[model samples]
Target: MKATKRQYAYYTGMFMILVVALYGIFLLTGKSFIWEGDGLAQHYPILEKFYTWLHQGSLTGWSWDLGLGADKLTTFSYYVLGDPFSYLIAFFPKGRLELGYNLLILLRLYASGLAFLFFARQRSFKPASQLVGTLAYTFAGYSLYVSIRHPFFLLPMILFPLLAYGIDHVLSGKSWIPLAIFTGLALISN
Candidate 1:
């Protein structure tokens, strides 16, 4: 039991160290690792539109911001602007949107790492090997690239491992709560 605790502590410490290093490297250089490409540039405008709606004492009415005021249903049907967690961005002040967004990316990346770690451990991989795989999986080229190019798509990727794990456990006679929670999160996240 003690050894497992020690192992988890080590894994957590290593993961956090990597997080700080990566963030520091990009942030201190006046650049961003996760927001560099089309994702932030493209999505921020839409997110701000949602924010504007919230502050206007409206959630989902016709948007006057569109061409001669198209229906707000366009935002819901065509874009991730309807995602529940997207409202989390509105909590940030206008000037701090970048900070909030980058933080969300970082949090998702670390959560992805932890999910991979859980999956590997469940498959009976050794602890050290699990940590290595977790780090590699989280920071792999595909994830980094997609996070910048297609962040809306990346939301599913983050929850996939966890959702599967939760379902597997439920199937194996464990409680169903975890599975239900992850499923809701996956469906509503984006």
Candidate 2:
């Protein structure tokens, strides 16, 4: 029997919910904490400190957390401070940045799956094949670990598959708008 439009959308929603639930199994099992190497030990704290600085009507210009007031710009330089989404880090409380990061990572992983699924649909791949590819890409070892520490870094990855697909369309006589939009997003995200 053929599925109705609502059924298809319901299936998609269920699948996405499953994907997110499975990806965050560590949290469900109590095996996950927001203490990945540099993310926990250093950068997240600096971001929290920076958040406080912003609330005080100033940027993070000094580093009392480090030895005697060093340059904050040097530290901020290593981070993608200008990225619009990166600014969302400040919304998380000083103590809950790790939780915020974990949530962000999970959401990004799901987004990566959706992006890949969209790209595969553009190629007319079978639904099963697209699902397999999406699962492989989302749960790849490198993605799992790196994204845990650096969800911001993974932002560009959500667009990479779409970027390739967009460029492919442009080469194949399709509109260039997708290509331009994807490229612009990737550039701004990085």
Which candidate wins on TM-score? 1
Please give the distance, in angstroms, between residue 51's alpha carbon in candidate 1 and its true position after superposition. Answer: 2.6
- Model 2 lDDT tens row, 50-106: 666666766656767656767776666556454454566677877776666566666
Relative to the true structure, candidate 1 reaches a TM of 0.76
- The global C-alpha lDDT for each of the candidates, from Candidate 1 onward, is 0.70, 0.68
Residue 14 CA displacement from its true place in model 2, Å? 6.6
Top candidate when judged by lDDT against the true structure: 1
Backbone collisions counted per model: 0, 0
lDDT of 1 by residue, 1-190 (tens): 6966776677778877877775577767887544545655667666667667767767666766676887775655445553545667768898887776676666667667777777677777777887788888888887777666655556665688888889788888989998899888776565
Candidate 2 weakest lDDT stretch, 10 residues: 2-11
TM-score list, all predictions = 0.76, 0.72
Candidate 2: C-alpha lDDT: 0.68
